[model samples]
Target: MLHALINGLGLGLLLAIAVGPIIFSIIKISLGYGKKAGYAFITGVCLCDALLILLGNVAAEVMRSALEYKNLIGIIGGCLFIIMGIYSFFFGKKPDFEKSRDIQVDYRKRDMAKFTLQGFFINLFNPGPLLFWLTTCTTYSFLNTNERILLFSTTLAVVFLTDFLKVNLAQKIKRWLTPPNLAKLHKATALILTLCGVIIASSVILKNFISW
Candidate 1:
């Protein structure tokens, strides 16, 4: 259990540090509509992650078998990251803080639900999370079922807590997140994501094709 907790924490931190569209969206929503909206979005992302974890457990053997093709998966995931990074960098809309603040003044239950659903679909359509969960499960296949559960639960808890902190921090510093600053942040995120994709793809190629 202790080992599981530690490993889960490590995995959770890795995820929390990884900048992607979801994190971008969470921060944007938090800055715009407040922490509640951010929480709603994170909840949706967590639920989707939970579903992927469940599926990985139920189909553990299949997932393990699939690992034989990890190079291919890496390639696909890398391409996806590159595409997402490019789109976000070039075409992402600037969040209108004034407009969002107006909406928040009259925020409703249905609006929360809509945000939740937005988070859900955004995460659901992203191949990254599914691939990540699958890879984690396969990598830790030595662990028994109970240990896996412990690790997964701890991981999820840490991720949610970390994301909550991020949202709160963003809300607190939102005044500094002017349009120009946000645009710079968006471009930075895009560069990081694209670089990650390139690295992943290159590592696979070097390992499989390169002699040394």
Candidate 2:
């Protein structure tokens, strides 16, 4: 159990540091809306992770088979990322902090719900997380059922805790997140998404065409 907990903590730390669209979104929400919004977003992501863990445990064989078609998953995920990146780059609305202050009491619930759903869908459609869970579950298949459960639960707890910390940190630095800086961040994210898409597509092409 101790070993599992330690391993889980390591995995959680790795997740915390992993750079992706979700991380950017979390920081953006934290800096824009507040810690509550960030918590809502993280909740959605954690729920998805929980669901994936459950599915992997219950349908291990199915997941194993699914992994064989990872390229297809990658293509779909890549396209989604590219589209989101474009939208963020071109049409992303800067959070109106002043306006939010004016109506914060009125719209708090609605905005929290919206941000929660946004986080859920974004993480759900991301192939990276899917593949990550699949691979990790498979790799640790040697462990007993109880041990696996312990590890997974612990890891998820750590992830949520770390995410909460990140939200607080982003909130602390919110002053630096000006409109121009946010725009630049969006552009950089867009480039990363497009590049990821091209890489996934290229991998499929090369796998099919290149012999050597």
Candidate 3:
């Protein structure tokens, strides 16, 4: 049990440092929206992780079969990223974070729900997390059922805690950001997102072509 907890901590920390769309989106949402929005977003993300873990453990065979269509998944994920990137780049609403601190903006529940769903799908379509959980489940299959449960629960908790820290940090950093700087940051994040999308989609397509 102790061993499983430690291993789970290591895995969670490893994932926390991983540079991906999820992290960027969290930071962006936190900086642009608010802590509540960030919380909602991470809620969706954590839920997705939990779901993937569950599927990885309970349906390893099914997941293996699903991997056969990974190319399609990659394409869809990539396109989603690309579209999000474009939207963020051009049409993303720039809220006045400085003013938001003093003002009680009535952020709608509908918006929160939308952000939550966005987080869920974005994490879902990302191949890295899916493959990761799948591999982790297979590698740790030696653990007893209780150990497995404890391990994953610990991992999920760590992930959520780390993400919560990130949200707070991003929020703090927003105070120092000027409008021009914020705009530049948004554009940079958008470009990175688009690049990530393109790479994911293109890599799969290229791999398929090479195999033929």
Q: Please, what are the lDDT tens digits per residue for candidate 3 over residues 1-212?
A: 99789868866875675545676677778777878999998999999999999888885444345765656765775777677678768986653444433312345756788778777988999876896677666545546678888889989999999999989998555454667866776677667667767876797799889999
Model 2 worst lDDT run, 10 consecutive residues: 97-106
Error of 3 at 210 (Å): 43
Ranking 1 against 2 by TM-score, winner = 1
Q: Which stretches of candidate 1 lie over 4 Å from their true place?
A: 62-109, 171-212
Superior by TM-score: candidate 1 or candidate 3: 1
Residue pairs with backbone atoms closer than 3 Å in model 3 (clashes): none
Q: Model 2 over residues 1-212: C-alpha lDDT tens digits?
A: 78667767766865765545666677777767778988998999999889887776665554346766655654554565556556655875644333333212223656677777777878889876886676556545445677888899988998899888879888554565566765566567556655555655566567767765
Estimate every model's Cα lDDT from 0 to 1: 0.73, 0.68, 0.74
Candidate 2 yields a Cα-based lDDT of 0.68
List the lowest-lDDT window of 10 residues for candidate 3: 96-105
User: What does candidate 1 score on TM?
Assistant: 0.61
Q: TM-score, each model?
A: 0.61, 0.59, 0.59
Global CA lDDT of candidate 1, please? 0.73
Backbone-clash count (model 2): 0
| Model 2 lDDT, residue 110, Cα | 62
Better of 1 and 3 by lDDT: 3
lDDT of 1 by residue, 1-212 (tens): 89788878866876776545676677778866777888998999888889888887776656446776767766765676677667767885654544443222345756788777777888888877886676566545546778999999999999999888888888555566677866676677667666656766676788888765
Prediction-by-prediction clash tally: 0, 0, 0
